[model samples]
Target: MQVIRNGFLSLLALGALTLEGHAQAVVAALECDFPAASTDDWNMAASTLQYYIDTARGWRVDEDSFSFDGTANIVVDGKDHVASLSITVSRQSGRANKTLRSEGRSLTVSGECRKMEASGRKF
Candidate 1:
């Protein structure tokens, strides 16, 4: 009887440890910065830009022209009265490339994942 009781206690302890490990898996915000635009037409659009990738939830940003989830490759094709920007995130590898055009001038930027943090609760 004592041996059976000890075995049950061991199983319960193992379950608790597993739960604790799973709780630590979480997603944090992601940010990327691009080069300065050569022309003033894209100044306003490039100033207030932010991007985030949540491993569980998906990708999010403040711009309306950009829409992406965490799973597939990201693509951004946006155009306004004064400027336009196109971006693509590679699926086969972890890399991103972007191009911004305004007033007959263009700027390009490339990005890669530096580090990912797990701060928030898991979904």
Candidate 2:
């Protein structure tokens, strides 16, 4: 009887621990998109975004690609520093030649992200 009772109590404890693990909140990656006015316009915008992510402390820029549309993944650590920034840009041209004047390029960036550490406690 004693052995059976002990085994049952142990099982219950294990179940409680599993439930607690599932209850913990996890930080998820945030995604964002920046649309360019023209295919040529993306070069400047993407460059600016990369610069911001690289310069920020503790922040990381994971990957970058450009075509016609642009997308980026930015990661910030618990210290509000950037952990990673992955970007994709796409563009398509058939017949017309595209020319981008250097002087016309303008970029502006502002903002900050805070990071939260994951608790070891389950759920």
Against the true structure, candidate 1 reaches a TM-score of: 0.33
Per-prediction tally of clashes: 0, 20
Per-prediction TM-score to the true structure, in the order listed? 0.33, 0.17
List the candidate 2 regions with Cα displacement exceeding 4 Å: 1-25, 37-42, 45-106, 109-123
Q: Candidate 1: RMSD over Cα atoms? A: 18.8
lDDT of 1 by residue, 9-117 (tens): 1211011123555643333333344333334333322321233343333344332222252221212244323435455544334355656554576655565432233
Q: Which ten residues in a row have the lowest lDDT in candidate 2?
A: 1-10
Model 2 lDDT at residue 56: 21
Deviating ranges (above 4 Å) for candidate 1? 1-29, 33-50, 53-81, 114-123
